[model samples]
Structures are given as C-alpha cells and as structure tokens.
Target: MGKVTGFMEYERLEEGYAPVQTRLKHHKEFVIGLKVDDAKVQAARCMDCGTPFCNSGCPVNNIIPDFNDLVYTNQWKNAATVLHSTNNFPEFTGRICPAPCEAACVLNVNDDPVGIKSIEHAIADRAWEEGWIVPQKAALRTGRKVAVVGSGPAGLAAAQQLARAGHDVTVFEKNDRIGGLLRYGIPDFKMEKTHIDRRVAQMEAEGVTFRTGVVVGEWPKGSKITNHAKETVSAEQLKSEFDAVLLAAGSEVSRDLPVPGRDLDGVHYAMEFLPQQNKVNAGDKLKGQTLATGKNVIVIGGGDTGSDCVGTSNRHGAKSVTQFELMPMPPEQENKPLVWPYWPTKLRTSSSHDEGCSREFAIATKEFVGEKGKLTALKTVQIEFRDGKLSEVAGSEKVWPADLVLLAMGFTNPMSQLLQSFGVDADARGNAKAGVDEKTGYKTSVDKVWAAGDVRRGQSLVVWAIREGRQAARAIDLALMGCTTLPR
Candidate 1:
C-alpha cells in the first residue's frame, strides 16, 4: 500500500533458480532469492484492496499486506517482526510452500499476483544477515512442563510458543537428530537444513529442551519405516512427568502399492529413499545407501512428494527418470472466475520437473515386474474418466524397464502404534482424532493429551502444521495457567 497505483506500474517478479546441470551435481538450495531492490519492487505491487484474501489463504494467516507495505517502505526489520508475529518460521514457508497466498492475491483474478513469497524470503534472510532475529526468552517461568512428541514443524512451533509463554517445554524426537521431515523428508535443494538448525538453536536459547534419539513410545522393530531411536519412554511416564502432553508426531505411515512384486528388492518407499540422502548430506554415513546412479528410475504418485523423488533421483545421477500420476493431466491454466481466491486444479511444474524428467498422467502401474527378487520393469496402462470413474483405455497396456522404483504415493496416517500407546482415538483416515475449537483445541480422547499437525489432519503442508502447533500451544497454555497471551 505504499503507492495506490503501484500495482499498475510494477510487474510481479519471480525468484530465480540456478542452472540444472550445476544444481544436479549436489544436494543444496538452488533457489536464488530476491535482492533488496527487487523485493521492494515486488512488495510495491501490493494493491490498496479493502480486503486481502492472501491473509486468509495462508495457512498460518501471515499479515501479507502489512509486511508488503513494510518492505515497500524499506522497513526490513518491521517486515520480519510482522511476519514472525503470526508465523513462527517464515524461512521454511518462504522457500518450500507453494504460496497459496499468491494464488488468492486480489490481483490474481486477472493479472499476475504480487510476489509475496519472494518478499517474505527476502525479509527472513535479511533479518538473519542483519542479526534482527534472536531468542525471545520469557521473563517468568510457570514451572509447568509440556512434553511434545515429534520435532516436526508442528512440534517445534508449539514448543517455541509454550516456552515463550513461561512453560517448560521439552520436545522428544525419535530420530537421532531433530527437525523430523524438515531434516529428512524434504530434499535439501529446496531448503537447506541450516534453516532448521538455526531455529533449533534459537529455541534452545528460549528454554526449550530437545531430546533427540529418545522416542516417546516404542517403535515396532523390523518395520519397513526406518527409526534411529536410541531410547524409549512410555506414555505413562510422560503423563506423570509433564503437566501436558502434545502428540505432534507427523504422519509417518506411507501408503504402499499392493500390486505384484511389491516385495522386490529395488522398490522402496519415498520416505526410505529421501531420509537416507538427507542423512548422508548431514555427514552421516549410511551403509548400503540407495543410489539412483546409472539406473532407470520409476516414481509413482503426482504430489509434492513425487516431485521431490524426481529431484532427488536427478541428483543421484539416475540414467532415466519417469514419474506416473493416476489422474488425468490438468489444464495448464485455471478458470479464475469459477474458482476465485482458492487453490485451483491445474498442472504445476515444479523446479524438480524442470531439472529433467518425463511425466505421464492418466497412467496407473498395473504391476512391478521383477526377476531374481529384484525390480526389472513396470506393467502399466493408460486410464481415462468414464461415468465419473477411472477406467483403463483399451490396448494401452505397456511394459517399461525400471531398475529402481520410488513409491511417493503420500502417507496414509501417523504410525498407529504411537497413538495407540497413549489410548488416543483416530479418525477414519487413521490420523489422531482431535478438535480445534476453543473448548477442544487439539485435544485427543485421552485427558491431558493433545494432537496436532499431520498426526491429526493427515498429510498436509508445513504451514498448516505451524498453525495447529501455535493454536495447540494456546490451548495448552490456557489449560495450564487459566489464560494465555499466545496468538491462536
């Protein structure tokens, strides 16, 4: 809102990416963020609209216009302040989030939307460079302890909020290190782990204790899902030790393809494949690590996870990479008038896709063809919508050779054993059953036990997890001290 006519004068600027060849050589952030002047011009594109749908479109409800105006005015510190006030970690969202806020921008009805995400990335980075970001240590201690299981975005946000509100917050992570998916599930090229490591340091300074390699509940031995828990604490132990318990363990059970040859040696879950690469990047040695080098790769699923698989495979120097999507390809552009101010069904090509990969839609994997108990190829068929149901096209079946197959079909729910240990109820989708009302905010069926993020909502974006974490912190704070100043 710096200039009423600025939206008409400035064009939306997009963030740049490094060359594919250079980036494919290693696992690192390839996004070239906006410069100070470039961010200012982008922010200036914010219109003087009476209502900002971007505010609501964002899962964490970031103050888009206020920050935009701040950036336009060159008040970089204030922009960071406004951004951090609502969202705990702007850096994470600024880099990896699809920027649904931009989709719902007022100008997006016809014209190109303002570059809100790029502005946010600039502000967050500038804050770090200028030493504007610091630990917010509470003056008083409530002496009440909160045990949060999972060190994902949801758990981290809640722990920070609770700690800032004078509650003694301790986060328990089963992995050998913290950050959960942020550390392992996400590819480093999208967002480096330094972003998460810094936040962990800040939270530690704010009186939050993180217990890495210590699982809250027992993980099933010999499970396909990997675990690095060095120790375990029971549900009863947490109930007795802490004033409140938050079950924020993210959804970890990946959906599997139950076709023939599912037990083949080369077919693996996307989670299994992604975490190892990230761990290796962090200087951890993984014996017999999965490598795509010189092998034909086939990835299943069309979501963000699938895209990540493609990017990681390219980095692995795979011979050939092909991605499969069960649904028909979407229109390249959305019909704005019909779906105004909301996420639209349209084809989106990620930076990963641009790196190099062939994508096929309306195709389903009929079977995994293998020999000698190892993956060899895939039997697939073209499908189409008929009578509101997907049916196979006649004479469309084909077999393609594949040495490795990564299943990125997405997660079904939080691993059940962890929830069951605490007597928590699960929704039909196998996610922890919890409500987000004034009275029942993130509360599980068991008293004093709460759940949030992907554990409660099934698979979702990082921004949504942050929202639930902050809200649940408010709820826990109120229950513990009868009032809370934490933002909901």
Candidate 2:
C-alpha cells in the first residue's frame, strides 16, 4: 500500500545468518534481523489484496496488511501496536514459526512472497528497543482468582490476558523456571531465554503471579520428561483456592519406538537430551548429562523436534549426525498453483540440516543394535508405501553405526496424571475434552475448570497455542463476569 508497484520493483530480502562454523561454537541467536530501512522496504512489498489470506493463514490471525502498511509508512510504534493486537509474542513466532502466512501470500502465486515474518521480527525488536513494550495493568481489580497450570506460551498468554482483565492470576510450572517447553525444549541457539525472562517480568508487572518449581498435580514416577518441582499442590487445593482453573499443561508424553534394544543406555528421548543442555545454558550443573560430543548420533523422526536434535548435536560437536524419516522425501519445490493458499507438502531443510547432516528418507529402523547395554548401531531398511501400507524393501537391510540414538518423534499426549487429577475427560486423541465454541469453549466436564492449547488441542505450533490461550482467557473472563472486553 505504501508503494503501488513495490511488489514488482523489489525482490524478496531474507534474514541473514551467522556462518555455520562461527555459530556452532556458541548457543546464541544467530539470525541477523532486518535493518529499519530494509524492513520498510520489505514491508512495502505487501500488495493491497482485498482479501488478506496471510491473516487466515497465520494461526493467530495476525493483522498482516495493517502492520505491513504501518511499517512501510515509518509508523514503527503503530506497527508494534497492530502486531501486539493479535499476537502476544511476535518475537517467538517470528524466530521459529515456519511462516505459513508467507506461503499463502498473494504474490507467492508466481513470485516470492512478501517477507512478512522478517518485517514482524523487525517490528518486535524495534518495539523493545524503543521501550514501547510495557505492562498493561488493569484499571480495577475483578475480585476473582484464576489458577493457570503450565507456563508455556499458552499458559503465559492466558495468565497475562486474565490479569489484564483484573483477575488475580497465578501460573504454576513444574520446571524450575517459567516457559514450559519454550524454556526447556527449544535450544538457546534458536531463541535465547532472555525473551521469555523479559516477558515474565512484564507479566509480573501487570500483576500476574508466577510460581515456578511448583507442580499442580502428581507427576508420574520415572517419567523421562523434566520436572524440577519441589512442591506439589493437589487438585483439591487449586479448586478450593481459585475461582477458576485453566489447564494449559502441554502434551509431554513422547512417542516411543518399542523396538529391540530400546532399553539400551545410549538410546534416549529427545526431551531428556534437550532439557539438560538448556539447563546447562541457564548455569545449572547437571549430573551425568547426555552429550553428543564425539559420538555418532542417529536422530529418528523428521519433524521440527528432529531438526532441533540435529542442531543441538552439531553444537555439541558430534562426530556425525544422521536423521531418519519414515515418509518418502517430498519435492524440493512445491506446486505453487495447486497449493497457493494452504500449507504444501514439500522438502524443508532447516538451518541444522544446512549445517551438516545425513538425511535418510523412506527409511525405517527395525531394531536398535547394541552391545553391553549401550546402543551401538541401528538395523534399518528402505521402506515403500504400497496400497497405503508401509512395507520394507527386500534385500535392503543395513546396519548403520551409532553411538547414541535420540528419538525425536512427536509427543503422543499430555501427561495423563495431571488431567486425571482434575477429573477432566480426555478426547480420542488423549487431549482434554473441550469445545471451542464461544459459549462453552475451553470448559471441561468439571465445573470451573477449563483447558486450552496442547491440553485441549493436540501438540501444535506456538502461535496456535497463543491463540487458544487468548481465546480461553476471554471465555473464562466472560464466564466469570457475564461479559468480557478481552479479545477472542
């Protein structure tokens, strides 16, 4: 809108990155953000499409065109305002989100999509630099209390929204710090913890209370997931103390590969391996830490979690890294005309893959081979899908050397114990049973109890979690006061 022919005039400019060698040495953010002028130029590329598919394409439904126009017109503060209107944490999504919004851009039909994520990243960074971000304290206290379990993006967003609506909000996290998975599951190399810390500070200033190292319900014994809780508050206590309870406890049960030698000492879930390094980065000394240094690491799973394993292992100076995917390799380029306004199936090479990795596609691991209780190799075979069923190719068996194996397969469900403690019904997929309607959205079978994010929907992106949290908060606020001004 700023420049009529801006899309035709300028080529897409992407965020730069630190060289592989230089970045692998330290766990710090390596993305070089767009400069102010560069961001303005990039923002100018937003075509004045009557219908902005990018808005619907985004999980949180961000007002893309408004922010892009604001940025192009040098209205940095207003751009931040428009951004924060829909997204609570642009910094987080800008850095990690796959940018499905870009895929749906009108210009993407034939040309590169507008650099929306980069512009958003710029707006957020500039907002912080200019001190535009601050606490939005409530005008009056609502004489109600809310207990939000889990401090991940969902919980944090809900707590912040509820607190701003004048309710006393307390967020309980089992981990030693706030930010459930964002603080532990994601490595510091992709996004520093400082972003979470600052947001926590802002929320605290807005009257949201954070209780870390406090588990809201019983944690299963011997669970591989991280839990640093020193205190456990029973569900009865939360129910009796708080007027409303919101469960944003994320999906934590990692899917297991129940193959031979899975009990090997060197085979571990990605959650177990990732959280230790994050703790180490936070200056905590972990005993018997899982390290990939000088070890041949085999990461199973082809999702974001697996890519994360690749990046972290490389940072650990692994001897070599190989990733396995049961699915066949996708096309390097998507058929844009066929899938313009929706997410397309295509090959995605992450920064970690670019760093270094041997990616094997359509490969299935039949067994984990080990000696003396320690994993040593993997017995694998090429697979093909016939009649929608996977079958191993004949004479394609091979044994690959491996010192460590990380199962980066996605999570199966939220911790069942926590949901059971609240007497919440679970869906067929093991998510908390709750509707998304405006009247009964997020409300569980139990009165005064609700669920959102991964607890209600299955494991999803941070942006989706934030959207669910915000909507759940609005639902709770309306249920409490019979009306609410909070955005959905």
Candidate 3:
C-alpha cells in the first residue's frame, strides 16, 4: 500500500471532460486523462486498509491496492503488470466500468475513495506509450483448438486466455468487424475503438485468429442489423471442427415497452440507434441513416443504454432531449453506514446527463402518441412509491412532444433460437444453465460446450464478463488437459 498517512492527506482527483459545446460536434472520447504527476498524487491516496474490499468488489478481482502502491512509487511498468495480472483489458473497464470498487472502498465509508479507475486508465495508457505492453506468446503449442462465439468482452477474454495457454483460439463475430458491443453498442464518446484495435493486434500476435463477418448461426433475414455476415457454419459443423466451443454471445434481446402504439415508425430499440452511430463514427456510410437532427428526442428506460442515447442524440444536434425512468428517483446520497461494502441506491448522473438532457424519474409512459405512423409525443403519468409498489397518482398525467424515441430498458435474455440450436439448457431468466461448481466449472448441459458472461449470468458489467471468460478459459483448459496454468 501507499504511505499510511496518504489517504489522510490527499483528496481524490478525477479526469476532466471537454466542454459540451465542443464535444457534441462529433463522436469521440471527451474525458481528459490525468498527467503522470497528477495520477501519482491520486494513486498515493490508497491506504493500507488491512482488508481490501475493493478487490472483492471488482468482478475481475483486479489487484487494486498493489497497482495503486506501484503507481504511488512511480513504478509505472510494475503497475501495469499488477493490473494485468487480474484484468485482461484494463483499458476497457477503466473507461466504461462504473467502478463498483469505489463503492466498496474503505475510505468511501466517510470520504471520497481512491481514484482507482483513473489510476488504471493512466497505467494502461502509459504502458502503451512506453511499449511495455507486448504480446504474451505461449512457449509451447497444445495443438488444441477453441472456438469462441461473439467478440464481446467475454469472448475476447476467453480467446486471449486460451491462446496464452497454448491452445489455438479463434473468435467468430457475426458483425462485419470484431469487438462486438465494444465496437458497436458503446459510443465512441465513452471509449475510442483504438483501444480495442491495439488489443486485437496483441491477441493476433499471441496466436489468436479472428474470423470477422462469419456468423455461426443463421440470423433472421429481416434483422434490424443489415451490415453483418451471411451464415458461415452450422452449430454441428463447429462442434465437429473445434475441440471445444465457448458461447459468449451476449444477451442480445432488448426489452421492449409494449404499450399502445408500440410499433410506431419513429420508435426504435437502443441497439438499432446506438450501433448506427458507432458505424458512422468508424467511417462506414449507413444508407438511410437514422439521424436525430432537428428532432425532439425522447429516450425511455433509465440505464446506461438510455443515457448513451441521450448523449448520442445531443451529439446529433437534436432540438431537445428528454429521458424517462420508471423507478422513483433515488436519494442524492447513500447511507454509507447502512450499505457499506455493497452497491447502494443513490442518484447517479452520467457525463451524458451533464451534456444537457431533461431527466424524469417516477414517471411511467402510458402510450406513444403518434400521427399517421410516426411517433409525435408520449403520454405519461407521475407515480409514487407506497407499500413497496409504485402507483400512479391521480391528476398527474402529461404529454411531451417528441419526434424520435429510443427504448433502452436493457436486455432481457439471450436469443432462444441460438441457445436451442446448441441444445443447451437455459435458466428461468433465459440465460444459459451453468453452475459455479468447481467440478463442472463453467460447462453447459451439452458436453464440450461452455457458456460465460451475459449469456450465462444475464445483463451485467463488462468487467464481470471478462472475469467469467477468464475463469471459463481456465475451466475449459483443465477439462481438456486435466490441468491448467491459466490464471483464474
């Protein structure tokens, strides 16, 4: 840990952001990173808390305190090593993760926690700048092949780990490019795609093959997604080709609001809207592009996806942006004493909210008001929490005009067709049926097949997906070789 008195002396210093006016012009990362000196100062805030709850709080179990101490002492290279020991992609989590570790910080019991995420971002960026991050090529090849479906965080992690374990690894992505949601679902304003590009290079160097624009299963002909691969191989064909199959396909089914006029022309899922912007940012010309210019935008279902829609709409030069959340607004502050070391209920305003958007909570949408076939406005009502239930209050109905609506309520489950094609059993929530038992590890009901991340656990953070993927890699390796050296 850093100096014992460091936490007592230092205050948290966070990364800066570009002005909204300038940043809204394009889709790019706006969070200004900390200088080395500033990052060192922030890292010094890590105290010797005897028990590090931050480690447990992090899904990847990143060696947070070790890296913090390394950064504090100016050991930049070692800091990156410590971070990489647990997390395969600190850069991704550093930028997009909500930092649950901060919520579990010892200092957070009373004061601001250590700037762990900022320190992580600095270490990763510094490692890249100094050329310390090189490919970790396995010394020996096992001649065993692994096929990982989906190129999201989980699949990438599993492929990287399996490759490093000397197993031939190949990632299959249906999209025209790799990096699944990282390249599509997430906006560039949060994390630039270059981070993913560099990692892809590193993985290639480590002997991982990427098959882009080749889908394993047949996607419906009229999918909202147009720019993807034609079906390349059947599920049985992949099983016959590879020694093992890892299903890391994310929860792709977006939950819908089945209210009146749900099929309006202007109403679209968040995935439909977000991915187009990301493609445009990547220099792809989207024919019949969905633009938010000159339209009043309304994003429903309060979550990261909704927030991202708000930010993207603002960048689209929308006339106005509004966000609606069905749940009641949380308290501005959490009661630390009661909820310490656990995620708490509190109001969190993302950088997107700061970009300019009217956020409404405790409101439920009754219907989508539209003219002809396009959405025109939304009929909503104010609600209050009572007896552990939300009830609409009388005489609180209102109408808000809008031209576009983005439904971002979050994903419900994995696609049933894909799961059924493999004959894998699904849990009640529609995720793959897998147990945490050490004996079976991350294996599915189907032999030689495994599931991890969102497909197994439902909607969760990217870091958790990485953790599951890494763990599943180790499990698959052990099952294949009767032993594994890959880190759990």
Q: How many clashes show up per model?
A: 0, 0, 0
> What is candidate 1's CA lDDT for residue 201?
98
lDDT of 3 by residue, 29-88 (tens): 999998999988888888899999999999999989999888889999999999999999
Tens-place lDDT digits, model 1, residues 1-488: 64689899988889999999999998999899999999999998899989999999999999999999999999999999999999999999999889999899999999999999999899999999999999999999999999999999999999999999999999999888889888999999988999999999999999999998887765577643335556779999999999999999999999999998899999999999999999999999889999999999999999999999999999989999999999999999999999879999999999999999999999999999888999999999999999999999999999999999999999999989889889999899999999999989889999889998999999899999999999999999999999889988
Model 2 stretches astray by more than 4 angstroms: 219-227
Residue-wise C-alpha lDDT for candidate 2, range 1-488, written one tens digit per residue:
55678998998999999999999999999999999999999988999888899999998999999999999999999999999999999999988888999999998989999999999999999999999999999999998999999999999999999999999999999888999989999999888999999999999999999988787775577653334457789999999999999999999999999999889999999999999999999999889999999999999999999999999999999999999999999999999989889999999999999999999999999999888888889899999999989998999999999999999989989989889999999999999999999868799999999999998898989888999999999999999999999998
Pairs that collide in candidate 3 are: none
User: Over the full model, what C-alpha lDDT does candidate 3 score relative to the true structure?
Assistant: 0.91
Superposition error at 476 for model 3 (Å): 0.4
Ranking by lDDT: 2, 1, 3
TM-score of each: 0.98, 0.98, 0.98
Report residue 204 deviation for candidate 1 (angstroms): 0.5
CA lDDT of every candidate: 0.93, 0.93, 0.91
Which ranges of candidate 1 are over 4 A from the true structure? 219-227
Candidate 1 minimal-lDDT segment of 10 residues? 222-231
CA error at residue 241 for candidate 1, angstroms: 0.4
